[model samples]
Target: MGSINYDDSDVLDVLIVGAGISGINAAYRLHDELPDKKYLILENREQLGGTWDLFKYPGIRSDSDLHTFGYAFKEWTGADIAGGAEILAYLKKVAEDNGIAERIRYKSKVEAADWSTEERCWFVTVNQDGEQKNYRARFLYTCTGYYDYNKVLHAEIPGIKNFKGKVVHPQFWDLKEDDYRGKRVAVIGSGATAITLIPSMANVTKDITLVQRSPTYILSLEKYDPIAKVIRAILPKRMAAFVIRQKNIARIYASFHIFRTFPGVAKAILGRLTKSQLPSDIPLDPHFKPNYNPWDQRLCICPDGDFYTTLREGKAHIATGHIDQVTSNEIILKNGERIPCDIIVTATGLKLSVGGHIKTTVDKKTVDPSERFVWKGSMIEGLPNYALSIGYTNASWTLGSDCTAQYVVRLIKHMDKYHKSSVVPKPSNRDQLTQRPLLDLNSTYVKKAEKDLPKAATSGPWRMRTNYWYDLVQAKYGGYDDLVFA
Candidate 1:
């Protein structure tokens, strides 16, 4: 064991965990709003960009448009749907341009954070380069997002171990080593990853089959927005970006409202659009038609109808059935159909996690997040000077996270103005509040991690809203009288 190093000489004004999009947004806000405050970003990985850096599979692109997903401080003058490498480069440029890159410490994984009432600070334990170190901070911010990075959701398939071919998960894909040229590939799952992989690998592989247990609502969107291009040509760069961003945001809000309010109409429109793109031989009934209404689960997006184009080109096929077993050379379906495959790619899903699985405690008493309630969709109840940067389920992730960053900065400013040392959300009638799931989605991953997540409420600040417009307004001018500040 290495010697534990404690740095008691310096205490950060704010300590942010995870150096991804959320963390980078938070850092920029702090730097711009509170320049005097000391802060640092601790990233567990060797690089930044969080999800963009983690996923290296082929045809990996943003589901949301870059104008809305990109930070408000910067203008994304590229295509709406950008690849993982392009997004990562954008993030790196943001960090470098704003001096955030210097504040980031790579390979620093937060293990535990304990708040001490006596010291009025959080004692954080971290492992850096295989050595344990300790640091103190006046405020703690968790921007780790809501999913597990080290683990992926396991799909159960009988005789998986008996298969002799290569089994790959998108989360752990290595493009350099995994060769698919002229090889028959079968990708399991109908989510975004599978939709992306089939289109991307169709040209290189001999034949690609998309195997799904159930269909998900998928829509085709233009890769480049013509309206955005016209706006950029007419207006100044910053003005154009702002206008385009607002336009995209309104479109997202309107589409979601329509889907939830008029499910039948939305379903019919989606069905018609899908049917038009797909070949006549491939029936829309079994393969494309999803049982659940749109937005019940997240809607998958394929830029420029790439997935459908691949299917129409005879390079890809769709198999909608439950997996019965896996043989050495093929996948056997419960319907007695066997699909030959040289490589099986499991694009199943991610495993949900809260606060990046960091152990949290207050004066040695363990803090179970499931028991606590979220306050203003940013801070957790009964937690001192702590804030969570989570995004919206129905819109671009950065919009909600940016709202959180603004709210946190406001809270910090309020604390500084009143000469307060700490602030915590302490609802008087905590036990009587009705509990709701923090994430409003009904997806498999969200449902599986419900018991491990924090609780929301039916009303007041304890309730969490997925509306980006409402959240933006609240973050800017919401009152904090319900909070306990000292």
Candidate 2:
């Protein structure tokens, strides 16, 4: 990676926070569209890949396929369900190929960003290597993910401290420190992490049990896409990638629409598919059934039905009930059942964070995101020249973030063409607009952070939709009626 010295007085065209998928996408777009612009990406971690680098648990992999998850400029010729390491390698390759690696500064955490209307710039404070540094930029773009990297949702299991065996959270799983070989393990929660871990550790552990208060929709997906393979074989690399990516996007859009429009029919179809994969002894009503319809919350995906295969092989087990208490060597259920194990893996969930918890101020007055509205799902209302790179919940995160990047690039081009220094969203009748949660999901993590996150209006530019097709068109041709350019 290339390093450069920057004086505090030097102002950049754009300052992007977080070197994850969204941040990388933004940097690539800026280089491709506005090569003359000076931009830098500040990553909090020492490595480039954010989530892919932080997570090191067994069976760490993408829940979404690479075709849709990967950027439009890049071609993902790997398996549909890729491991964490493979994903990280792809990100590194993208950065290296596009000369984005040199623009990234590691171990630089943004603490606060204050906007100055008089100067028409953002004064950013960063914590770098235990020392404070300052940077100035014309525009600020935040790609920090929605979750808190330093903290995990606390598991409220009673008497968890009494457990004599080693307790571990999947978020902070230490492979070398915590060994489950030939030892019984009790995996808590039924989210994506728990499902992935149960099947992955099933063979190594004496036995693994998945304990959940409620079940989540678990679907078995193919690891490799046959259609993608055929397209790649017939067409050129770029052409094949475009075709495969579009096909997957359409498929996911249609699937989500069908699930929401005809929930009863969708539920029946999902129920049958799940039942067919599981053994007869493991009933579909309690163990596999979810109270909410599909797509209500993010579905837990099991590549190649590995989770079901483990259950059928008697290597993995499931318990659906509230935890009464954790004993020295057993997890007792409220129904008076005992699950004995040597280790407890709390795969509860993640705590939601917005803007990487960076403090924002406009002229020294604190700006609360929860009170502000999101404009075009990219810029926060009343925030000048600031863009947020957030992704889709129903589809691959890259698709939504890419749309945001495209929109920001377009906005920047418009500003430069008209000799405008800054632009901020100002809805005329904000008080009359109906407010909604920015994130559409009803997931536990989202619900917990609803009041802390930015708001979405019921209609107009302030509304945020998870639809990629609509957002893509808006990004390319949407009008800036609500924006005030200065």
Candidate 3:
């Protein structure tokens, strides 16, 4: 941020914020589709991989398979589940292959963005290190993700200060294994993070305990696909990957449909599968039971039953209860029980953050994000020249992000055709639409911040659906039907 100045005549066409998966995908599409327009990605971190680079824990892997989580442009030929480091490497490869590495301004965090109705542009203020800088762009795409990366979210337990052990959170893992090996540990969550950490460190640690308030659904698939191997050997790499990807995409769609439409059937089948991986002495129902239906929260994917296999081997234990307090040597439960441990892994979840907490102003008046309507789950209502890369909740994050990029490209083309500088979707029939929660999930993270989140119209083209096929049709063939561009 050293005196970086731009000429008034040379304002960027777009300022893509965050160098993570969504930002990178947007950049690729913008570069490919609108070559003449100038654009730059402003990243808060020094690295390409946002979540992958940020979390450096022992067993950090993708909750979803790599095939769909991967960009539509690239094919992931690796195992079904991908490690964090491997995912980072893949992101770097994408940046290098696309020649977008040089276009990224690392360590640049956007603090605020001011939109001028008269100028039809945005004045973005960013902080790089201690230096502050300004950038102007016609459109701002915030791909900063939906969670707070800097601060880990956890409940303040009674006597947490008294715990005389290594207290750790998965978000701030030190990337060191020596500290946890041969130590008794308790992971305080049953989500993807806890599932991942327990499996990766269970064998090395003396004993591991998964302390959960409630259970979540976990599914298992083969880490190495034998069918993929045969297909890859028979056809070209990309072609084989494409065929396998389509098959897997269909499978994912069908699985989500089954989980949502026939929750009881899904629950019974999942319970049976989970029970098969545990010892007969253990009761799988109460320990692994969830009150909500499947897909209410994300269903975690265990690579080749790694989590279940480790649990069955007596290397791990499950403790389901309320945290009464934290003692010097153990965790006191509400039921007068104690879990003694040498280390406590938080695995608690991330705080939801949108727009990077960047203050947004339109014509000097502050824009309350909650008041904005998420049009088509990308553009916000009344906030002109601004768009966000929101992804599918039921499918891979990239599936929606990739389509959103394509949709934005179409929007930009429409703007050009109309010779308009700003475009924001306004409800054609606002009275007819029922505003609902932006995220329809039972996950703790989503629930905590759902009120502060934007609203989506219930019955309109602007409404959001978790189905990838519906989104695909909406994003590809649908455009500007319910929007008013100015």
* Winning model by lDDT: 2
Per-residue alpha-carbon lDDT of candidate 1 for residues 44-147, written as tens digits (9 for 90 to 100): 99999999999888998888999999999999989899899999999999998887888888899999999999999999999987999887999999999888
lDDT against the true structure, per candidate, is: 0.89, 0.91, 0.84
- Evaluated against the true structure, the overall lDDT of model 2 is 0.91
lDDT of 1: 0.89
User: What ranges in model 3 sit over 4 Å off?
Assistant: 1-9
> TM-scores, in order shown?
0.97, 0.97, 0.96
Which tens-of-lDDT digit does each residue in 47-154 have in candidate 2? 899899999999999999999998899999899999999999999999999889988989999999999999999999999978999999999999998889999976
The deviation in Å at residue 172 for candidate 2 is 1.2
The candidate 3 region of ten consecutive residues with least summed lDDT is 1-10
